[model samples]
Target: DQQVKQNSPSLSVQEGRISILNCDYTNSMFDYFLWYKKYPAEGPTFLISISSIKDKNEDGRFTVFLNKSAKHLSLHIVPSQPGDSAVYFCAARTFSGGGADGLTFGKGTHLIIQP
Candidate 1:
């Protein structure tokens, strides 16, 4: 069974509006959560992250919120721009590997920014 899931395959948002992407996981062993933004063929670039201990983390226009009780997390982008149109993946990993272990990634949600 897939440990992580992104139920929404795609989302459309108007420029200057907010974009929210959702993710869920069933593995309680995961202590670290990360969001990655990817273009057409390039590798995924790190977006934001939040530890299981913290409920939220923000950087610039990007924010990641974690709800350990519900085994869910979400990414919020304020004032969505055309450049933000890309595939976003939610990833999680256990802290046992000292940050060396491979991350379990979701299917990814394709975000489209309406110009």
Candidate 2:
């Protein structure tokens, strides 16, 4: 079964507005979550991330919030611009003793920015 899920396959937002993408996970072992943005023919680039210990993390126009109790996380982009349009993937990883575990990714959500 898919451990991470992005219920909405696509989201459309107006320029200069706020765009919120939601993600849910079934794996309770996940302690770190990351969001990546991908454009056509381009590799996914890391955007924002949040640790399970923190409720929110913000960087410039991007903000990520994690709710460990609910196994939910969200990425918010304020003043959405045309460049913000892309496929966003939510990934989660469980930290082991030392080595890093592979990340579980959700089916990406496409964000469309409209003028």
Candidate 3:
């Protein structure tokens, strides 16, 4: 089974603090990992990603780390802001799958940036 799991359903943090979200996977074939941020009534926007070959990646205030040996990954948001208060979804995918390949998303973690 190709299952991506986000253990925490939500996380709360003070503004300007670091917010860390964790995710795990059961399938080793997943090559592409992505994180999406969503606001109310709007579609999720791609925040960052890392290929399976890489161990760590970062973008400005966002960072993603992948550990293939453990089948675990995490997203870190530094100096969390009020605008960053939204749901975050972690996803993984592969192109070589038998069917039309697409993203597999976790339920999402509701990040609360306390202002």
Top model number, TM-score: 2
lDDT of each: 0.96, 0.96, 0.94
Error of 3 at 67 (Å): 0.8
Q: Report the lDDT tens digits of candidate 1 across residue range 1-115.
A: 9999999999999999999999999999999999999999799999998989999999999999999999999999998999999999999998674455689999999999999
Residue-level lDDT of model 2, residues 1-113, one tens digit each, is 99999999999999999999999999998999999999999999999889898999999999999988888999999989999999999999988998889889999999999
Model 1 residue 100 lDDT?
51
- Backbone clash total for model 2 is 0
- After superposition, the stretches of candidate 3 with alpha carbons farther than 4 Å from their true spots are 97-100
**Model 1 misplacement above 4 A:** 97-99
- Candidate 3 residues 12-60, lDDT tens each? 9999999999999998889999999999999999999999999999999
Model 2 scores what on Cα lDDT?
0.96
TM-score of 3: 0.94
Question: Cα-based RMSD of the predictions, in order?
Answer: 1.0, 0.7, 1.9
Q: Which scores greater on TM-score, model 1 or model 3?
A: 1
